[model samples]
Target chain A: MRAVVVDDASPVPSFEQVRSQVAAMIRSGELSPGEHLPPVRQLAADLGLAKNTVAKAYAALESEGLVVGDRRRGTLVLAASASPETDRVRRVEMAERAAVRYLAEVGHLGFPAVDAIDVVRRVASAD
Target chain B: MLGDWLSIVVLGGLSSLIFVSGLGPFTDRMLDRWCLRYDVAVDQHGREWLRTQLRRARAWRWCGFAVGTVVSALPMYANVIDRNRAADFATPANRFAPWLLAAAGSVVGELLSRRPPGGRRAAHLATRHWRDYCSSRWVAVVGWSVPVSVAFAVQATQSRDLGWRWSWLGPAVALCGSAAVTVGLRHLVNRPGAPDGLDRLVDDALRADSAHHLVGASVALAGLGTSHAALALDLGWLGLLVGMGQWLAIAAWWYVARQETWNVARVRWSRS
Candidate 1:
């Protein structure tokens, strides 16, 4: 029962926000194989976003092989694929969300994108 | 003829009672009874918010009840005024139409209460299922028995008591009603629930508690339809006995609801 938040003020598009959060949930095994993703219309209404935005996010997930959609059974997470491509997609999405959150928080402090990335590089090497 | 007319008058008077009850005193009692069970009252604001919400819901439900009463009463009224067409008007088709309409109208009214509050901040990620709100095994038994009751009515039709036998309306309403209730309840259970920012557990609890009324409405409506079926079949004492099964459904619901309320209260107060 993990949740997704749509931060209205974030620079990321709503669709990406939805896609990334749901993607993260699947990758972390929060939403399992055969588990239903919330109905697109319901998720859209709750997030106060357009239904198309949610639908587009779902489309992105289906394209990534993270979920499958059926008109009758609704959108569901698919079993994890061992394909390297699927793994890369999940990795990139997880990093993108972390980056977005970091950038959003740092952007408020008047830091440039270059400075934020530099901080990330410095912190990674230090670790 | 005199006894028949007297019976019509008595029936008409019951319709009026149904009307006055629709004005909302009874509905309010129903609302309070079911809601108070899950009134978590995390604070003064949450409590007051729920109160205002319920008041608004009560207003909408009253309108629905009024609409149902008027609809059901129209046929009964026509039956009286056009006494010459009494046989046609008093047929089981028209007789049970009111109950069916009234049940549907009430379900519509329940839907109206589902407007999400303005500026909700977060939503539950969990997709609610019927099992989440109502999973008692006993409830399953009562729900399954509704079909048996309907089936009994069908079996009763084999008798050549043409004057007192059942019509298709009773079974039709029960079947169609089961479908309608299924769709209606599924929507209610899964619909965007309590305002997003409320404590998730509290929000879930409030929604679950509200759903109990819907569960009750469903069972009560099925019971009414089944009761009507038994009565329509004109099984004499046997029909009356079967018809009383509705009360059993209601009683089972009531006992379960009360038990749930006490269980939650005891757990919450004791632990927290």
Candidate 2:
């Protein structure tokens, strides 16, 4: 997977940005199962984040069971453990989260709630 | 003497041609290997830039060869061929004329070869960055300075024992000259503006070039400084410690340069 980008100006914390990006890559199958992520220090330098931030993101991924950190080797993506129902529920949660973020962004752009919903509906139906 | 001059001219000209022709392809292959190892995908513009550098290198090599040959030949003729006229050329100034000529020729050759396609501002920024790289760390300065300083100190104290009032002059001149050349050469080699086609790749390549120059300058300065110190102190044992320090400095410089180049390439690639 490509290096994760963290925007300092964003409301999301840097660690969360790293965590969410890695998680999204995992769900999208871009980061393969058993694939090794870059070392924490390497990733931190690449992303311009503190070592603690990258380490925290990796720890969060471990807790979520998406990846495992081996002492000798590096961090490895774990084979996903979700059942089909759980996977569907996870997808729903991700979609709702994305929708909320989209709404928040559009709201700041002077988009009314009805117009935002209409825009989403139009984009979804067109897709 | 005439036979020696003939042999030198013939041999030097042939060697110079062979060296330049061989070095161009060798350097190109080396760059290709480096790119493969570092995962740097060179675009069309990068290739063009590499071609330009190779061409310039060949040109500079030939210029150096020609200038060196002329310089050596003049001294040889003065000292050997023209026995009666040797008195005039035997002065210290005349003896050192070849080196001065070669140095001047190299500078001119470098300037002629380093005419970048970019604008002045880009070239200025590039030169500034290259200078920054050369003198970035106090440790590097100290690394070159300590040995030379020690040599000067030793010379000052031992000048009476050695029966020379100006024993430190040569070492001082050598130290200052090498330092100046190192900084100047580094600035000359770095091309500032982005290449026309592959902006990112060219940028990475230029950075890698900067790193390579830094490593070269550091290693050369280390050798020069240590040798001058050994000469002044006349202490063979001190060589061991100095050599170790030089090696450590070289390793550190190489590591730093490699890290910088890798970071640049990685960041550029990631963005793309």
Candidate 3:
């Protein structure tokens, strides 16, 4: 399995780092549907994270229908979106990557990502 | 006298050979066999990396053996042969010399085996992983602390019985030593950065390394307890039991460390 790198020094919290990375992996088809992710405890230990942090990330992924957690089995990946297609996956991957880059850019410019999103929403409403 | 020196030479030489040359290849062969049995495909680069590590380890072990032999021989000559003060050839210092030599040798070996460029990034990632592990498992930190506390209590009680006006001295020292060792192991193993290749295997390797450190610490404590029981409490049987426990712990540690290291290699290859 491809390892997720979490940067503690970044403004992003560990759980967000985990969540986004897992999401990206799913969208990129690196983690396929029905593939089991590592156990929460194991991943937490591997990443030197609190088990809760990883659990929270997994929970977020589950809520988004990106993965499912079973008591007997482990956490398994689900389709990234409503339908699985090469183009759809590509679009989702690109969108996610763009969002990350935009957020990072805005942050570097000393603006909140939410403010930028609000500005985009206002423009869309006017249009 | 001649026989004693000869025996030391033979034993030291054999130990050096086994530690420096024999174990690495033996471990590698076992890893290969296990991987084959499990249908794990090891990448060429991963295999090369593992081999390189083994080579470095062997060199360290040899260096340690050589240093230990020379240092130990000095005491044997001066205390036993030259002075004829005692028939006992194995003084405490002499017995400890090899381990000291080995420790120094390993450090030197590590220094010599510098990672290539981009190693820093790998190391940073590994450290971050380790920090996450430690932070998440706060309970484990507490678990380790319990042993050190217990050790302190044991030492303190013994010291008081031995009529030390400063009973806390022994306990304080013991506590500091245990804490230092625990912290040192955590830092040492985690500092190297994450192993490249299979994430699963890297996790297993880290787990195994942690287990090895915990077991090693337990063994050390058991030895300390045994010594205390025998020397302080005059409980020979109890000391014997503790000594046996220590050996058992050591045996378990060896098995886990060996198996996990190989498993780590397997994962690295399988992923590669």
Candidate 4:
């Protein structure tokens, strides 16, 4: 169990920090596949987070295939390479959602929907 | 035939509340206005608030929804009314029980109130995520209504002897469907770099605030109507009617209040 900080003062969430730090730990081999992680509720208490915040971080990890939850055994790390596609999909999904939000903002402010779509296209296509 | 016609119209009305609320389009308009006003590409405050509220609302709404279910089901659970006795309103107990449950469910949930004042400044501070939920909650509301309407149909067709048994099915289906759709929508639309999710975090709070006042009013009306209808019918078939009315009133009121908030937020955002 590593120390996880809840940086309410920063715009970045505690979960983002946890995700990055945990990834760093995995990369450095300080944490390894098959290693068990703390339960969400316990970790939240340790980190001074709302339980859901910890759960969100865990969900991100789980979705990335960086971790897998064993019904009886709790959440354990998975070999990062095993779910490379999951990582790609997650990234794509994040990009898509962000794009949608951006498009939505543009459309709502009295821009034409087609124009908003064109803007996104041009921006993405640009260097 | 008369009863069937009545239930269909009533159920249709309930379903309509889910669709014609204009919440989604209205929310989008508001968000656009906010973005234009701020002259910023991203809605930082809106996103922050939405993420926070979605998580908080979801956890709490489930609890409230559960309590509402239990309260609404009390009459049947207590055996104060049964299927066979549903249509016969000649008895005082039969007449009052279902209405009592409907009112209880609607009003009890209302006791947990959150409303925001509608104005430009108040709106400027509103989040895009809340606005998003305001725009899209209809999908959730309408999705859940499918099962509810089906269950109501089943309850509508059952013979008198099977009234009580079938009566449970409508709400049982509705409760489960509502929970599933709500959770699914939350997950599917969860915003990254945001807290909680999309709608539950920010807009739901404002929605709760804006519409909190209507819970009492809806409960009073639905409860009174249901009780009266229950008293008239010996078979308790009218429980469906009362239930439908209560759901419509609350859902519609929630949509309207949230939409207004969303609109104001957009207007303020545009000017600011």
lDDT of 4 by residue, B1-272 (tens): 45544544554455344333312233455545534433334356554453343334333433334343343333343344354653443333333333334333333333332222111111111122333323344434534454545544454545334444334433433343344334333332222222222222233333433233222223233323332333223435765776566566455544443344344444543232
Q: How should the candidates be ordered by TM-score, best one leading?
A: 1, 3, 2, 4
Q: Is candidate 2 or candidate 3 better by lDDT?
A: 2
Question: Each predicted complex: what DockQ?
Answer: 0.21, 0.01, 0.04, 0.01
Off by over 4 Å in 2: A1-127, B1-15, B18-31, B69-74, B84-143, B146-150, B153-157, B160-178, B185-191, B214-218, B236-272
Best by DockQ: 1
Pairs in steric clash, model 2? none
True contacts kept of 4: 0.00
Report the C-alpha lDDT of model 1 over B71-125, residue by residue, as the tens digit: 4445455556786665554455444455455546545655654445554345545
Choose the strongest candidate by TM-score. Answer: 1
Give the range where candidate 1 chain B is weakest over 10 consecutive residues by summed lDDT. Answer: B262-271
| Candidate 3: segments with Cα more than 4 A from true spot | A1-127, B19-40, B58-74, B84-185, B192-230, B243-246, B258-272
Question: Which residue runs does candidate 1 get wrong by more than 4 Å?
Answer: A7-12, A24-36, A48-51, A64-127, B1-36, B42-49, B56-88, B93-102, B113-120, B136-150, B161-165, B231-236, B246-272
- Per-residue lDDT over A1-127 for candidate 3, one digit per residue giving the tens place of the 0 to 100 score: 3667766567888898889988998898888887787777656654667789989999998777788777677787877765657437645755776788888887888889889798668988999
DockQ of 2: 0.01
Report lDDT per candidate: 0.61, 0.54, 0.53, 0.45
| Model 3 agreement with the true structure over B1-272: per-residue lDDT tens digits | 67667766776676666565634553668547644533445666655554555466456646675667666766555554565654455444464355445444543443343332221111111212232222223224324534554554566566546544233332332343245345544544433333445334543343334434333333333333333333344455774775465355335424433443334343333344
lDDT of 2 by residue, B1-272 (tens): 66757765775676476446635553667667656655667765676666666455445434544554555455456656666775564432332233333333333434443323431111111112333233345335534565665666476466535533234433443454355455445434343334333444455455444444334434434444444344455556875776565456445534643554444434433244
